[model samples]
Target: MLARAINYAQNQRSYMENYLLDGRCSISNNAAERAVKSYVMVNFLFHDTVKGAKASAIVYTLAETAKANGLNIRLYLETVMTKMLDYKNEPDSILEELMPWSEAMQKSCGLNNGTI
Candidate 1:
């Protein structure tokens, strides 16, 4: 089972490496590994059930991504959650707004202050 899982992951990685794909890259997923380590730390400390672990992982990933983008973590999250609650809609498409590369944030503080 473990071997099959590894092979499946390799195949998926290869598929994602297609040059024409917008975010495709022929590289190991080390960045994602490091990003998930925060959730792993929480799991190690609390040993929560799968549902709680998943929720923590999602929130950690968002916060970490915000930090990576050079945004103030607390402010970014507050702004995002406020907008999300105001919209009262699923936020799948709005994830881009949370990213540091968005012009909305750049215009607020300019490039230097905004570059994470």
Candidate 2:
């Protein structure tokens, strides 16, 4: 058992060394674990099929990205959906304006506007 443990540690030594070389490298994945915890719980509670789960994952990711960008989640989603309808037949490049980081979206849906 001790020999197996030592072999495992030796195999992982390079990874540990990399962590030591980077000050910003986390020793554990707790932040990533916490980020996915809600999605896991929501999948169990709300998703009934694989298709539903995939759709939920996309929406959840968009909402999280919007929140991280300081945009009001509800307003940002609403604006994007509404705008998408108008641009559905247009070129995909036009959709860039609908992103949370876009100047127009920031002005309309950003937290600084007291919309949140």
Candidate 3:
């Protein structure tokens, strides 16, 4: 059964070309995985208010998203969080700069050289 499934996938390879077009998934769960670290740390260090916890979750989410986008995790988080705190009323376009698929992140990092 497994061999049959593998054979079917191989036969349908062209149909899945778009997903593999860049020769990579262009997505990684690593950021989401790393996000847990900050939450675990904060949960231990500070007593959680609902709002405060929620804020941390958002930061971690963005941080991981930034990481997955190829931005240096440390730098992007620091820069974005600082901006977010100061510019609480910033427009969506500004915040959108931090998205995982943001071109800013893509341009900063070159193409993936990893084996697909």
Q: Which candidate number maximizes TM-score? A: 2
The model with the greater TM-score, 1 or 3, is: 1
Q: In model 2, where is the ten-residue run with the lowest total lDDT?
A: 38-47
Residue-pair clashes per candidate = 1, 0, 0
Q: Tens-digit lDDT track for model 3 on 1-116? A: 99999999999988766656675664454645665876777574684587887887777677656655666666666556566786687677777655557676455432352211
lDDT of each: 0.67, 0.86, 0.64
lDDT of 3: 0.64
Say which prediction, candidate 1 or candidate 3, comes out ahead on lDDT.
1
Off by over 4 Å in 1: 1-14, 18-20, 23-26, 42-44, 90-95, 107-116
After aligning candidate 2 to the native by TM-score, how far in Å is the CA of 79 from where it should be? 0.7
Instruction: Output the lDDT of residue 7, model 2.
Output: 97
The number of the candidate with the highest lDDT is 2
Assess candidate 1 and give its TM-score to the true structure: 0.63
Model 2 misses residue 23 by how many Å?
17
Clashes of 2: 0
Q: Which residue pairs does candidate 2 place in steric collision? A: none
